[model samples]
Target: MDINTICVHGSAHKTDYTGSVTVPIYQTATFAHLGVGQSTGYDYSRLQNPTREQLENVVAALEHGTDAIAFSTGMAAISAVMELFEAGDHIVISDDLYGGSHRLFHHISEKNGLTFTAVNTTDLLLIEKNIQPQSKAIFIETPSNPMMQITDIAEVAKIAKAHRLLLIVDNTFLSPYFQNPIDLGADIVMHSGTKYLGGHNDTLAGFAVTASNELSEKLRFIFKTVGACLSPFDSYLLIRGIKTLSIRMERQQENALKLAGWLAQHPKIKAVYYAGLPTHHGYEISKRQARGFGSMISFETDSEQTAHQVLERVKLILFAESLGGVETLITYPMLQTHADIPASEREAKGINERLLRLSVGLEASDDIIADLEQALR
Candidate 1:
């Protein structure tokens, strides 16, 4: 079936008993078994739930992975993935990932003896140079967060295979609709389902999907042990939101390109960082590897004052944290998304006071453009 058809009807949610088109919330914590030493596939909510499984199955199918595990939040999914490595193991990661993920590696994982080396993963050579003997995986965000830096996924996957290391791609920016990293050779694909998969920004969820059964086994063990599983209701919400993903992404991308073009031409703008723009350094790479340039765009103004003025003056576009919703959101990475990053490191990646990241929504292009125009003026 086509992807859009799968989005709405490809769910593994068939309860012939009730004949409900949607997956019903299996709210109970435990399920009654048929008999001793026998099961009906589900015994506990923590291990699995009917509703969550429906979402998981759909996600796995969408990403072309064998199995998937859903989580309470994006970080939880990543936390479970990190457990696949040992204490002394290491990994190479994108230098400009979300602040929360950076915190996970630098603070939690590093303290636990799992180390990381952050590099600009867009350059395959830089990633290759950073891989150590103990490096177990390559963890990267394509069209990386805030900066919109694009990585050549297939190239990096080759490097990972040559080194016998796992390749983990966070597909939150592109979602499964635009890019399936696994199809391009990713060992595992993760998502901050709170963003695009949830579409409405009303649910907090995460997903870790893998084509390799070995990785799936390890992740399943960690997911059950850590107990960061998504709730039945939230899983239902995600399933509902994902049904419109293809259409929503199409509209969001259209609005984003228009906004990025407008911002790039503005006199006060310093630079616009969107892979969709022909002038962007990663534009060609983005086109070669993915279906489309995603909606997330970051642009810088002449001064922090200008950024703050725009943030405060905007009436329609909300000044908020988080992205991939139906409504437009403007976030200041310096304080909002990437605040956990050190000032020196943040500025080094061009996420400075003057930088603003936009999560273009399903709003009308003219309204989104007009709001930015008046705010910038």
Candidate 2:
């Protein structure tokens, strides 16, 4: 089926209950067994739920993967994948990663003995050089947070295959509508469903899709054992959100492109980091890998004072930490999202004090642009 059709009807069907067009939420905690050791597909809510299963199937289809597992939050999904590795295993990750991910690798996981090297994964040579004998996985986020750095998924996957390393991509920014990393040869694709997958700020969820059965089993084991499964209610919301994903993303991307172009020409803007902009360093590579340049963009001002001024002045866009909702959101990476990272590391990665990140929404392009224009002035 085409993507549009898949969005509306994928992994869901009318049930006998009401013959409703939407999938009915199976809200029960546990399913009754027919007899001893004989049961329906589900046993307990924590292990699986009908609503969550529908969402998993939809996300798996969208990502072009064999299976998907939904989680309570994006961090929970990341932690589940990370659990596949042993204490001594090393990971090579993109330098300009999401701040929460950086905290997970640098602080939380470090105490458990998992070491990581933050490198520019866009440069395969640097990534290859940093891989150690114990390197088990290549973790990356393309069109990276704040910086919008694009990584070559295919190239990185090839390197991972040759070196026997797992390749995991955080596909939160581009979402499945814009990019499918599994098709590009990634072993696993994960998302902060709180963002694009949910399409609204109403729910918190995360998911991971795997390309191979072997990897799927590993992830499933970790997911079940760790028990961070997403709630049935949020799963229902996520499925509904995905139905309008393509259309919402189209408008958001349009607004983002226009805004990026305008910001580039503005005198106060020192740099605009958006793949849609021709001058952006990642524009060419991003175009090759993604179906569309995503709605997320970041820019830097001359001073931190000016950055705060812009955020305070912007009336239409909300000031918040999360992204990929129907409403536009603006955040300061240095203070809001990337605050956990050390000042020295953030500065080195160009996540400077003057940088402001925007998750463009499905608003009128002209209105959004006008709001930004007024705020900048």
Candidate 3:
């Protein structure tokens, strides 16, 4: 089946008794066993819920991995994956990281003895130079948040293999609809299903899919121990949301290309970062690696004042934090998303006060542009 067909019917397991179209949400804390030591494949909700398992099964199939695990949030999934390392272990990471990830690696994991080094992952040499003797893994976010940086997943995966390091790619920006990192030699693929996979921004969810059974077992052990798995009801919601993913993403990317082109031509705009644009450095590589350029766009204005004016005046695109919904959203990364990083560091990454990120939604392109034109005026 094609990806669109897989998105809908891939994980539809045998619905023996009910024959229901949707996977029935097994909303229960515990399931009854027929006899001593007998089980119905599910023993407890925390360990595994039927509804959540349905989601995991589908996602695993979608990502072309051995297995998948679902969590309450994307961070929880990441946190569990981090458990693969010991206290003294080190990891190489993308310099343009999401603020929450930056926070977790430093404030939470570093305090516990794990260390990380962030580098410009687009350059393979930078990654090679940064790998410490203790390095156990390389965590990456291609077309990274706010900045839209792309990394050659296959190249990074090769480096990981040479160093006996695990390669973990955050596929949140593109979702599996646009990109599948595991297919490119990555050991693991992670997603904040809260963003694209959930589609409506109504649910908070995360997932990790492992390319090998060995890694899957390790992650499953951590997942069972963490007790931060996704709820059964939310699992159902994510499943429904994924069914329309290809269509929603098609529209969203269409809007993003139009908007990015317009921004590049705008006199008030200083820079635009979008992989779809031919001017972007990673445009060709992104084309070779993924199915489409994602809907996320980041651009800079001539001044901070001008950026704020647009943010304040936009009547159609809501000034918001999260993305990947049906409605358009505009985010101020310097403040809302990347504020946790040091001021100097953010400025160096081009996430300065003049930068604004747009998450184009299902709104008509003309209406969205009209709002932006009015706001810019």
The window of 10 residues in a row where model 1 has the poorest summed lDDT is 10-19
Report the error of model 2 at residue 240, Å.
Answer: 0.6
Candidate 2 per-residue C-alpha lDDT over 165-190 given as tens digits, one digit per residue, 9 for 90 to 100: 99999999999999999999999998
TM-score of 3: 0.99
Off by over 4 Å in 1: none
TM-score of each: 0.99, 0.98, 0.99
> Per-residue lDDT for 58-171 in model 3, tens only?
898889999999999999999999889899999999999999999999999999899999999999999999998999999999989889999999999999999999999999
Q: For candidate 1, write residues 52-161 as lDDT tens digits.
A: 99899899989999998999999999999998889899999999999999999999999989999999999899999999999999999988998988899999999999
The clash number for model 3 is: 1
lDDT of the structure predicted as candidate 1: 0.93
- For candidate 1, the per-residue lDDT at 210 reads 95
Q: What is the lDDT of residue 251 in candidate 2?
A: 89
TM-score of 1: 0.99
Those runs of model 3 whose alpha carbons end farther than 4 Å from true positions after fitting are none
